[model samples]
Every structure is written in structure tokens, then in C-alpha cells.
Target: MKWLLACIAPVLLAAWILFLSAHGPASWVLLPGILIGIACAAGLSFLRSFSPALRALSLTLYLLPLGLLSTYRASAFSVSKDFELGALPLASAPSEMSIAQLPTGVTYRSAAFGYRGGSLFEPRVFSMTAILIKHPKGDLLIDAGFGRDIAQHLATLPLPFQLLTRYTLNKTAREQLQSSGYDLTRLRAIILTHSHWDHISGAADFPEVPVWIPPAERSFVQGEDVTTATARSIKSLHIEEYRFDARPYLGFAESHDVYGDGAVVIVPAPGHTPGSVIVFVTLADHKRYAFIGDLAWQLEGVTEQEERPLTQRIADFEPRLVREHLAHMAAISARYPELTLVVAHDPRSFASIPKWP
Candidate 1:
């Protein structure tokens, strides 16, 4: 019983706290439920001690279903396609432009956490990428990789898995930009799709560049400790609230035009997070790319249409809402064939693009 409590209590407590924090639920209601649950769990484990095999079976029954529930709930927003379709015509690789890739860092993770059928025997290795847009006006960084300080801070967070196992911040965005001959201070602006730590950790590096963030993201950041601080600290940053606009590249959607040109546009793509926006860039050559942050964490999410496993999905009190949004994103992507979608964490997409530095 003690061993069971030691194992299950921490996981449940962490999950519960994260749940409460994500949703502003009344703590009074949750506290008693958690306590009762813990008691019931411990009591049941004590009773099953007489049969070790039964205890193990009970544990598996309890956890496996919970994992499935979490995964389905987390993917409630994910879109399901009944038939397999070939790649769209516009989705073809660009023929005119040169592409480069910069490795931000390597994320380490258990095989169970990565691909759709990742097994303990098949360990998964992944890397984070930042694709640089070498524009005529200036260089635009798609996803800002972590700075030195923020990377170290994340290394110490009380997460079940090491961030380094999932992401590596090998080259800071600022350093890469500078080394590539682009002045850090002269950067035009940064468009962020969401406020996940991995996406926004480099915000501190470019203090003065105007950051264009989706309206919903601004609200989401208020609930997170580190990100809220980073959001508040970004100097000269511009919060682009959700607005109905009629622009050339943006068409009619909730979006913000950074330079009022068709060059860079921030469009709301809110399933990954409340305020998640897709940074759409039309290169000088007229090729378009959409940087969808965490909308799809892995390339297989796009190619194979595999939703994240239940154990790894975010639990924001009401898991159904999050799942529904993810499904919506998949549906939208399926409908749009004109834009090349870029998932922020997918190293393959990043590798296919040009690196800034």
C-alpha cells in the first residue's frame, strides 16, 4: 500500500494540480474529491495485496483505461479522415527557393512518448528546428528556440520527463541570427503562434523586437508563471488581439498583418492553445508557409493523422474542449491545400526550410 501510494499519489496530485491550474475551477470542490479518491485507491490496493497478480491486473485496468480516456479527451479536437488521400498539388515542394535548417536543440523522450506506435524497445529521437526566412527587408525566425538562461530554467522544472529528452536548445536563435550576419537589434518583428515554453523561451533574447501574438495567446499566458513573466518582459512587443480583417494573404479571418504587407501575417489557429496563431509568411519568391506551433507536435501527426497518445495529452480540467480544438485544426488543414503547414516542433519540416544563421 505504501509503495502504491508513493507511486500513484504523486502522479495523481500533479495531474490534479495541473488540471486546476489550467482551468480556474474552485479548489474547494476538487480538494475533497482528490482526498476521497486517494483514500479509495489506497484502500483497494491494500485489499488486493493478498494476490500480487490481481493487484497488478487491477493497476493495469485502472491505468490503461485512464490513459485511453486522456488520449481521446486530449484529441477531442482532432479531425478523423475516413479515407487516405494523396498530397495536394499546392502542397508540393517549392522549386525555386533554396532551403536551409538550423538545429535549435535535441529533445530526449521515451519511445512511448514519440511516434504513434513507439515502444519501449524502439526509443524515439527528435530535434527542435527554427526555420529562418531570408527576406529582402530582413530575416524572420519562424520559431524562436530557447535562450541559454531559459533553457537551463526548463531543465529544472518538475516535469515527469526531461525536456532535454524532448527538446534541445543547441543554438540560441539570437546567436544563430547574429552569426548569419543579421543584426539582432534590427529584427523587424516576431510572430508567435502560441505560448508554450518551448516556443516562447527565446522571447527574452529579443527584448525590443515587436512580437505579434494572437489575442487568445495573451490570455493563455496569464495562467502560466514563466511565460507570463516573459510576455510581460518583452520590450516593444505588440499584442495582436483577434480581429476580423480583410487582407490580401489573410483573406477574411481573425488575423494581424505585421507590416501591412503580404510578407508576414499572423492568423488565429487556436486548437493547440486558446490564443494559438499561425504565422503565415509569403517569401519574396511568392511561396507561402504556415508556422503552426504545436498544432501538430510530430510530422506523423500530419502525414499519418495520428493523434497524440492519451498519456501525453494536455489535461486542462475539461479535456474534451482541448481534444475538439485539435480535431478542428486537423480538419482545417485538410481543407486548405494552398498553404504549406509547419508544425513548430517537427524537425523534418524545419530541416526542409532555410536556416537563418
Candidate 2:
């Protein structure tokens, strides 16, 4: 009876946590349940009737799932082979064209949260950054980042997300632009990589500026999906929907060249969301960047081809589509070593871009 009790407690504990991770309610609600399991397991040590060997086995069983969850590798998907990408398109970027990064805030998390094989002890700072693309025609903001009303924005999220997420806000993208004495008139649109709250929150601050998105994303924002709750809550957004022409830029089947000069091209890579995109920006110096939004949370998603852990199913709308796009991007990175692939949440990916003064 003693051996059976010792063995069963840790096994039950691991199974309970795994079940909650997948199907539990809010993260806060999960805490009490998990703590109770821990307390029960800890209490079992007082059973001196169990042999020392039995106690050792119980401890090992309790920790095995945690170790696997943190470091288990997922099978990698293959890159698209049917599509052939020819020579890079010539970009007629204006001499005055430039780009900058506006870091609004960061969320502290373990590397394990971003991708599989990442260490739980290793801390990763997820950047809530927006990009500014200055053009002779009109300037564009890649994403909104955090906003002045971030507290309200956060409150709109699911309670589980709110409980698990810890963030620190700096200046919003709107505040940064205004403080820099930027000409608001030159701003054409806030081109969203996706309509997720973290990317669209600051757009509320610029009610007058139009928010450009692909048609699919417009539907997502207008739909009843819980993911776009924050975006739907912001009634002031001026939405301008656009479509993609059947022009293959890189391996992508369809592309929308925003500037018509091969300088700023938008390509659909909708796995993270129904309308997620990869924005390709070419500068006057011919430096190129591909701002991939949440396809992978970190550089390793492209470089090493690591996908998010299975437990983080909530992070992706369609995991299969994400893997397809990720494999596609990974192939592009390999073919064009000079082009920089910027993952939205990876701060290190923005090191080359200058920060807004």
C-alpha cells in the first residue's frame, strides 16, 4: 500500500498538470489546483513506511514530465519544393528611405515558452516593438506595439493569458512618434502584420490614421473569434482592407507591393492568424529585411527550425499552417544569407535597426 501510494501520487500530479495545461481555464484558476497536487505529493514524504528507494523513484517520476516539457524536440516540417524563386527583384528605394525600431515594452518569459529545446532557467525577453519605415511617398508603421491604454488593452485578454503574461511598458509607438516631432501628415497607414492585441493596441492612439490589413485579417478582426477581442474593442480603428495580386515574390504564391517599387512588399503567410503576413522592406542601401510576425517567437524558429511546444497550442491558430510557413521562411534564409529575418517578439532580431530618438 505504501509503495502504491508513493508511486501513484507523482504520476497523478504530472497527468493533472498536463491535462490543465491543455484544457484548463484561466492560468490563475490552474494555480490552486496545481498547488494542491504539489502539497499532496510533498505530504507523501512523511510516510516513513515507504522505503528510501521508493521515495527516490517517486521524486524522479514527479520531475520527468517537467524535464521533457522543457526540452523535448518536435519533428521539423519540410520546406516547399514545388515553387521556384528566381533572382531577387530590383528595388528602387528612394535615397531618403530609412527604417527604425520603436520598442514600446517587453514581456519576461522563459525561452521554453517561445520554442521547444529552450531551457526553463534561461530567461527570454519578448519585445513588443513597432517598426517605422520612412518613405518619400508616405511613412508607414509596421505594428502598433503597446499603447497608453495598455492596461485596458490587457484587461480585454483571456484571464489565463493575463495571469501568465508579465509585461513592462515603455513609450507607445504613437507617443514615440509624437515626441520625436514627427510629421503626422507623412504617416500613411499602420500596416498590421496581424490583428493580435499586442500588435494593434497602439493603433487606438492614432484614430485618424488608417490601419491597413489584408482582406482575411479584416474578416478575423470583424469575426467572433476570441483572439481579436482587443482589436474589436477598439472602436476608433480606421480599417482599410487590401488584396494581394497574383505576383510571386520569393516562394510566396501571392504578393502585394505596397510602394510598387519592390521596396515594401507584403506577402501572406497566414498560419499564426488567418491574415498574418511577412513584410519585406528594402532600403536605399539595398539592405533587406523580412518582418515575420509571430510565425516563430524567436530567431531559432527560422535559424534552427524549432517549433513551439505542443502545450502552447493556444499560441497558434493553425499549427500546421505555421509549420509550413516557418519551413518556407527557413528555406529563404538559407538561400539568401544576406537578408535578415526578423521575428516579431525576438529583440535580438532588431539589433541592426536604429531606435527612435
Candidate 3:
């Protein structure tokens, strides 16, 4: 029994940390839980050096936290229930309001890393794709994926993150646009979902083009946050900070209607980052899409309402806020089945959009 408890304590503690990392209100809350879990596991192991009765009682106490963590991890969010979002907003999308996807690169990850209650054995391909939204006013590029300096950008990340992340680069957004003879003048601004390194890496390639971002995200880029370290490293980025008006749209409290045509609307969905946003684009065919940047890594996060597991602590500025927005987006998805929720990394989510030449 002593030997059994000694070997299992460390294993159970590791599992507990992974299972409960993002379950608390803030990311900081995870540290206490981890420290306590480690202490408890160590205490149990130490107890095993004494009487058999004491060892049994300590083992029981240690198992309690792991059991609790397992139960919490398995629990579902409120996204399971139906939500009312009233009628879809009226949109007068121009016939020329077109959209296409630029396949930049891909990163491989386990399904379990993306969300709670996912299969550990299943490998998922996460696309580093950029979106091109063309309008008569000016075309907008959303989330520049995989730049020429991707290697350098990646190196800026922590060593552990670099070791875990395995990616393949296909084409940078700039190369695709230039190769296709796309007129640079028509491209007005590059609107970012957030200023994360992966999403903003290709922005450096388009030095002349202004990168449109919300005020919050702009601060994130300029601030001393370690997460935005890569973004700050890029010297050529021209940021145009935009603000949201008091107008409400589709359950969101604030919205910025670009082009004043209701064809392109942006809403603050901060959780992934202080400046993270969801872009709603309505094409001429009346087809609508919501580009939810890193809100959930996969379609299942919206369809099934599963939040990120341990990655939320590293990926999200506020995990609780992320969960809240995920629930909201899930509700929105349930109300409008036709609306395409394009998750940033989920390659399958970009199926509807035509590929760039």
C-alpha cells in the first residue's frame, strides 16, 4: 500500500493540475490549487513513511481533490440550453462584398488540448489561415497568418511552448496576395481579431497597410505584457485604434459598423485578450459569418459549447471571461444555424469561404 500510494500521488497531482487549471475565476487561482495539490500529494507520500492507518487516511484526503476536479472538468456550460437572440439584423451587403480564405500554415495539436472532455489520442490540425473580406469601399484582411519571420516570432515564445508547438508554413498572406496579382491599393486595412503573435505575425509583411484594432488590443500590443512580446518585436506595424459605439447588435452591447452598410460589423468579445473581437460579415448573397478569433479553437466549442481546458491559462487573458463569451457565442449559434462561426485555428470552420488564388 505504501509503494502504491507513493507512485500514484505524483501522477494524480499532475492530472489534477491539468484538469483544474482554468476552472477557477482567474488564471492566478490555478497556482494556489496546484501548490496545495502538490503539498497534499507530498504529505500523503510522507505519511506512508509512518503507520499504515495514517497512510490510508491521508490517501483518502488526497483523492478527494482529484475526484472533485474530475467532476468539474466533466460538467457542461450553460451553452447546452437554447438562447433567444431576436431577429437577424437587416443588412444591405453590396454585390461586390466578397470574401476568401488565405491558407498560410497549420499547427498540430491533440484534441484534448483544445477543449474539455476531448479525446487525448485524436490529433487535430489547426489552420493559420487569413481571411480577405473584399468590399467596394476597401478590402479588409482579418488575422494575418504565418509571416516570413515566423521562425523568429516563434522563438520569442517560452521554450516549453516552442517545444510543444509543431507547425507547417504553406504561404504567407503577403505572398498569396502578391502572387495572385491582388492590388495593394484596394486593401484598406488589416483588421486583427486580437494582437496575439500567431494572428499578427503576418502583419509585418504588409508594412504600408494600417492594422485596424480596438483600443484595448492596441494597449495590449503597447503594454508590457509578456504574451504580446512577439507583437511588440515587429517594428513596422501601423496601428489604427477604433472604438465601438453604444449601438447594440445581436445581443452584443456595443458594436462598430464598418462602411455604415451593416455588411461588416465588429463587436467586443474580449476574453481571449483584452482587445479580442468578433467580426460579423454579411455577403451580397445574404450569407453571414462571425469570425470569432480564438474564442474557441474548434467548431465543437460553439456547437457543443465546450470551453478550453488547460490552454486557457496560457492562451486567454481571462479564462472566466472567455467562458462567458463562449456561452454567449454558443447561444448565438443555436439561434442562427445559418451563421458560420469561423474559429481562428479550426481549419474545418473555413470550409464555406473560397480559397485564394
Candidate 4:
């Protein structure tokens, strides 16, 4: 144990410094990667009973980014077979108002102001998009895009935060909604799949509307879970009590039909966040779309069966859960080839999708 601690001190220190610089001293999100670093440092100082040769080998861990990438690519997370679940319970009644009933199977209005992130050579566009769902009863928005004054707000954050995850927006959701002449009052609620910074940042614009959050996600902001703690940047949470019934779709065994209309179902696939969800929108045209929230930044990640490297602590909390979720998504995609798997941040899919009126 002493040798192991000594060996990886470089990795831990590097991770700790980076996390501290990005999040600052007071951020509780620092618990995961930073705690081990402090513990290891204390161990080295107090114990000092390890071989120098083992330490050298562990210090080389950072030098081998290829090895790190390979380990991430070699996903070893397994789903629990013992966990039994049933298919979604029978709908109380057929949904009277489904996408099929709409003019062209629901109008999906996406206020997308995307940015090209990652590397300059292989930059992938990530859409900071807010989707407005129009139903007869009321209007609902999913995942608020960058809100008004986003630039000013971001400018207030740390320099490392801005540089590491550089966000460039073309338009804010509030700007888009206003320019499009959409009525804000009609927006009865905002459905948040998780409480990640990007997902909830723009929610500040909808103070009047109730924000629907899953049970686990509600606890995340309340600082209950250390492993998956969300930065309490946004507040005024109005959690909606919805039931997640047992149901199977492409082998996934639990889902909640939000409106009791089998068409729009919320599948709980927690990994990116404790309460992350996959929103399924099945239209009458036989086109089924799964709006997977940060399950992967792009659909290719699922189709290729890969995840982002471990060094990324800003978005993901559990690598094991992410690996298992990706495997399930891959299984579903392979089993049902016709269905379109939409990634929340994939700019390609966002650009191609039609807008609602």
C-alpha cells in the first residue's frame, strides 16, 4: 500500500492541483479526485517506508497518456445481472395527445448556440441547446441553453475554468425564444435530466416556471451525495414528483411515461449524473428518437462503444456507471438500427433537427 501510494503521487498531485485551480478551494466537488491526493501525500510524509524504484514507475503514469486512454477504452464495467426489473407498466390509457397527433409528429424547437470544443485539429461542436416541447396541455422546455448574459457570467469564473472548457455561444435560449416570438408564460415547466452546470445554467431565465428534477438529482444540489455532488450555482428548484415505473425498451428495464402516453418516456440511465435520463420521443411516422443526456457527448461514442478519458472530472462522476450505460445504449442501437440516438451536446444532430413553431 505504501509503495502504491508513492508510485502514483505525481498523478494524484497533478489531478489535485488541476481540480483546485478549476473549482477553487471551497468547492465540495473537489472531494473525489482531491481526497485521495491529500491522503496519499499524508501517507508519504508519515510512513516513508516504500521502495524508490516503485515510486518512479508510478510517476511515469502521466507520461503515458496513451496507456491512460487505452485503459479508458478498455471499459471493464459490468451491469448487475441480479437486478431484476419489469417492462414499463401498462399505460392507464392510450395517450390522447401524442406526437403523432401533431402536424408533423411534434415540433421540436431547439435554441441551439453551439461551440467547437476539444482540440483545434479534431474539434467537435457541442450544442448548448434548449429544447421546447409543445403539448396541448402546456409547454415544456428541456435542458436550458446558455441564458442571457451568459458571457458576462462566465467571465466572472476562474481563468482555468474558461480555458479548460471553453464555451462559445451563438445565441442564448432567452434570446432565441424572444426572437422567435415564443410565449414564455406558456412554458409551464422545465425538465432537467440532471443538474450539471451546462444543463442547468440557462435555467436561471425560467424563475417563474417550475424545474422538474429527479429524486437523486434533487439530492445532488442539496449536497447529500459526495460522489456525485453538483455545484450549487443555480437555485430555486421546484422538484416534480414523478414515478419511475418498471419497463423494458431495447433491454433497459425501467422508464417513466411522463404523460402516461407511451410516446414520451423518461428512461433513468444514471452515470453522468446521479439522476441522468434518456428522453424517448416516438412519433407516428415510426421514427423513434432518444435524447440521451450526456450519456455520451456524441452518438458516435455509443455506436463506437467508448467513453471520455478519466481525467475529465467536470462532467462525469462514475466511470463504471458510464461504461455500463454506454454498453446498454450500444446494445439498444445495435438491436434497433432505425432509431435515432440523439446526444444532448452533439452539434451535428442539433443542426440537422427541425425546429418547432
Candidate 2: count the clashes.
1
Candidate 4 colliding pairs: 87-246, 87-247, 87-248, 88-247
Clashes of each: 26, 1, 0, 4
User: Distance from true position, residue 88, model 3, in Å?
Assistant: 0.8
TM-score of each: 0.65, 0.84, 0.83, 0.68
* 142-245: candidate 2 lDDT, tens digit per residue: 99899998889989888867766678999999889899999888999999999998999989999999999998999888898888999999999999998999
Which tens-of-lDDT digit does each residue in 269-321 have in candidate 3? Answer: 99989999999999888999999999998777777778776576778899887
Q: How many Å off is the CA of 334 in candidate 2?
A: 0.8
lDDT of 4 by residue, 210-289 (tens): 87877877766677443222235445545564557776755567777766555567878887877888887665444566
Q: How far is each candidate from the true structure, as Cα RMSD in Å?
A: 9.2, 5.7, 6.6, 9.9
Please state the error at residue 44 of candidate 1 in Å.
Answer: 14
Q: What's the CA error at residue 315 for candidate 2, in Å?
A: 1.8
Name the weakest run of 10 consecutive residues (lDDT summed) in model 3.
17-26
**In candidate 2, what residue range of length 10 has the lowest lDDT sum?**
17-26
Maximum-TM-score candidate: 2
Model 3 Cα shift for residue 340 (angstroms): 0.8
Q: Residue 128's C-alpha lDDT in candidate 1?
A: 58
The superposed Cα distance between candidate 1 and the true structure at residue 293, in angstroms, equals 1.1
